[model samples]
Target: MTLDLQQRANRRMRRAVITLGVLVLVLVAALVVIALRGGDAPPKGAPAPQPSTTAPKPTATLPPDDGGYVAPAETVKLPDGATKSGDLPVKFPRTPDGAAAMAVASARNAWSLDPQRIRAGILAYASAQYRDQMAASADAGAKGNREFAGIPATGPVPAGATLNAWPIGVKYAAVDSDTVDVLVLLRVTHAAKTGTQPTTTLIVSPGRAVWEGGDWKGTATDPNQPLPDPVDIGTVGFNEDRWQAIQEGDRL
Candidate 1:
């Protein structure tokens, strides 16, 4: 009976050892598969990896920083045969192309309050260079007084006076180029109880001028329309209202 029991025990031990060996082999195979999938498997003949979501982005190109957004206007070069005068080359629309350029020019001109007509008048007449003389004359003219106290026509207008009317009765007049006009109007433009300072002036005066060429030469400019020469500023011209206002109290 003892011999039989020992044999049975030995058989059982052998079976148990074999089962443990089989389980160990299975575990080793599973670990190998996991390692291969992690990084060691033969890349499956796949393409190289693309950038992932967490990868850094490429740098973007940006425009150069300048004081102004507009690229500096480039000077145009003219063709050899396009010379206008001396070494200067003339290159531009030989002919006006329909209304595009004209339309743009007109729009820009209209945006300005002053017109070329009034500008022409200033060039042909008022000497802005002589500010003091004009101011003194203006004072005398408005007060119906004269700076050359002896000469009733040459006096300074009193301090506190305004010229508040359109010197020229007509709103619009056709003036040819290169002419000067002296306008006379009655306006009260200051804070005086005397009828001299009307709430608003009702002035009717004359503009003396000659039409020469296509330019109206002598109009006047106020703080708004002032200029070295009116013709130089706007191609269209100065507005009559502002010019007249500048020479306010001085109108006869």
Candidate 2:
């Protein structure tokens, strides 16, 4: 009877262990199902997550620069026999070639028959060194200056003579890091002449320009040099108002 009781006790212990294992497996399966379904949602009355309240940082912006020159203020007398006041100085092309064009155009404007305009051009356009040289040459009664071209010691231009200089082409050579040599082909005409058909002079002017005051200042180092005969590139009407504008130091 004691042996039979020991067998029955062992059987009861085994059944208890199996029942515990089955309960543990059922609990693990329930947990896995809940995990796969993504846990429970928040209570229905809870507020939604608040958006960030801090302001966004502003992006940086730079001031605008056209890379061109701005003309200073001046008072100029217009060609219409009216004295006009200039509100702002003219702006020229900011590039090297553009600067060369302005230099030549201003030089051409200096050839006006008006004495005052001639003086103004010298003051407005020429380099400080060139200006001093021109003054010294004039005081010495020199014929002409290499830097100032056909401007005479006595007068800048002849009486009743007006010369219009237009550049046909421009070629630039780097003389050094700071200097440039420009070969400009120009057609010069005297529209004020009494002749029915005005003769024009096609010339090649070699100018040496140095960077000064944020712009290229050109001087006619070799004004007498003539190029090979050039073909007629046609002509345009001479506008006095445009001449006046250039005289007033406008960048064209």
lDDT of 1 by residue, 1-252 (tens): 133443343333223221110000111111211222233333221111110001111011111234333221211121121223222122213222111111111111111112232122122222233223322332222122111111122233344433221222112223333222222222212233233423322222222222223211112212111112111011122232322222213331
Q: Name the runs in model 2 displaced over 4 angstroms.
A: 1-94, 135-161, 191-196, 219-231, 234-252
Clash counts for all predictions: 32, 1
- Name every residue pair that clashes in candidate 2: 71-89
- Worst 10 contiguous positions by lDDT, candidate 2: 47-56
lDDT of 1: 0.21
* Candidate 2, 87-165: lDDT as tens digits: 2122333454444554455435433334344444444445555554433322221121111222232444444444455
Compared with the true structure, the alpha-carbon lDDT of candidate 2 equals 0.33
Model 1, stretches more than 4 Å misplaced? 1-139, 145-163, 166-176, 179-190, 193-200, 209-216, 219-252
